[model samples]
Target: MTSRTFAAFLQRSLEELKEQGLYNTIEPLEGPNGPTIAIRGRELVNLSSNNYLGLATDERLVEAAVRAARTWGAGSGAVRTINGTLRLHEELEEKLAAFKGTEAAVSFPSGFACNMAAISAVMGPGDAILSDELNHASIIDGIRLTKSTTIRYRHSDMDDLRAKAREARDSGKYEKIMVVTDGVFSMDGDVAKLPDIVDIADAHDLIVYVDDAHGSGVLGGGAGTAKHFGLSDKIDLQIGTLSKAVGVVGGYVAGSRELVDWLKARSRPFLFSTALPPAAVGASIAAIELLQESRELQERLWRNAAYLQQGLRELGFSVGATETPITPCMIGNEETTQLFSRRLYEEGVYAKAIVFPTVPRGTGRVRNMPSAAHTTELLDAALAAYAKVGRELRLIP
Candidate 1:
């Protein structure tokens, strides 16, 4: 039976969230999440998916998934450390290692799990982690799971990071110090200052961890942010997601063979959570191979992103300081942002609003992701929708 206290707490919390305009109402998509989506019998141009290279719905990947399902059954049937580590898992890890130009790699069920597993496995009470203030929620949660001290430096502030590293190092209160940051900030789409971060880590003998979730398959010819800055060898841990640009599912940490070995041995998620299913593994392998085979998809993605971003800018919408394809159309008010997204839906666009907890208050936005699968005609139509909504909301002149 449900506890009365628990029920009351849940009711009060939900009411508070609703009054604050923080309740997120999810709408189901009627079909595959691709360049376009169907909702309530209406087809809309989808600009909210992380399918950067559009491999999620690619026929090749779909066929690979189907083949894998047939070959390996529906599930791996156990946790990885038990009996679930299939040959496909090994193959996917190998492909990831090759893709990231690392000596080895280890996979996790999800990108969020990678953070929870890796950070807690390697860091603890005797160590300290210097994190970027604007790091993802998963990172923050991972830091919370650790008993280690966490020092947050200002977002992308290299000087603050250096000072924190120096202070932590000089204090000598910890045995190990790691500086962790996202390779590409998801919200703002700005690339991390990896060269500077690497330099600071080198100066202070700090282990470097980069969660390149948003950079993989979009930067460095699709190798990722570390490779983009030619610092692949310098970064101690390079984390990436198969769900994003790879257009599959799962996550991995690519680094030295010793690091991968340590993670395989100690990471809790890899030990307890069920391994990625054969279908996702196969699709991920195909996606990585496709990325390695040619830069055509990436080129298409960049061109589409540039076109959409330019269109928004020309429409007098602020896109923020985005170095990658993730475009955020800034709307300072939460209600307005939600209304703006609803207006877009009515106008045949499917970009969603990001507000409150996802971003800082008063920094709400409608995030647009232009994928490789989208045609110029689709982008032009999306732009037209944006223009209409902006005018209707008085968000643009």
Candidate 2:
């Protein structure tokens, strides 16, 4: 097609998205993504950010970043293979290894890249990956990129997983078998049954990979889902993001020392991509240190989450099967979910809608992330807004 025709097609697609209320319009956060943010000249309660531990705006973290930047300069200058491997990077890796209770750890530029690089590097061609159906998009993409035989089981369904594991092991069509799942399902706020998954992996002799992007710093009093279930020693690969609870920009894989060395020698993202900046590395190290020092933040986070979940439930809104700090209020249709988010925004709350492609079509929801930084007064205000919107939309009677 010519440029004009392609342009017309793009416009039509965007128009269709707008008509369906699925069009995403970016709203610039005037300041840091904290308990509240200024958007469109209004201060709205922020319930959409992944800054679970509220360390993004932490004074200590900022100081650490400044200190590192002053000492190490701005950028790392190249990939890890070249000059990017700074002292801060090594320190961060050591800190992450200790945090996750692993022999060693390897850091990557982002969690998504870590998934893409690690999955593809370790398993390829004739290998089979038994993945959870509700795994994160990054995991799905990584599995696809590997060109491996992918078998998807029902979300957190051990029975289905066992069935698939049996089939994969008995088939004798692949060299290796692996099980992939998110430590926590983001949309539904449910946690992966790590103990069950570990048991299955042991029986099936499958390499286990758990992406604890949403669980790290929130569960196990900060270690993650593996630690929460006391299966840290059993699980083979523990994937995590520094961006969420740690309030930094990067990802990592914590596992056996051999695996870390192997990934350093093999993972394409680590080989080709630029390393994380000194500032981010320093901040992440500080975050991990903070998490280790106290569970006060984690306790407050859960306390806030419980309060929000209870309030939403008492208001007669369905919170689905949330087993973690992530509280998702289900609204059946995509249109309703989007409108619910917009209405919440209008009411000075900033919870975002998760619909259609993010979740299944009928499982659309407005995911509310209650953080430790959120004060009781702020939460009360947000809950009032939710109550008003629920009533207006008839989500609650």
In order of appearance, the predictions have TM-scores of: 0.98, 0.98
Q: Per-model C-alpha lDDT, please?
A: 0.94, 0.93
The residue pairs that clash in candidate 2, if any, are none
lDDT tens readout by residue for model 2, 123-215: 999999999999999999999989999999998889999999988998899899999999999888899988888888889899999999999
Residues 167-228, model 1: lDDT tens digits: 99999999999999999999999999999999999899999999999999999999999999
Candidate 2 C-alpha error for residue 302, in Å: 0.5
Worst 10 residues of 1 by lDDT: 16-25
Question: Candidate 1: what lDDT?
Answer: 0.94
Q: Which stretches of candidate 1 lie over 4 Å from their true place?
A: none
> Once superposed on the true structure, which residue ranges of model 2 sit more than 4 Å away at CA?
none
Could you tally the backbone clashes for each prediction?
0, 0
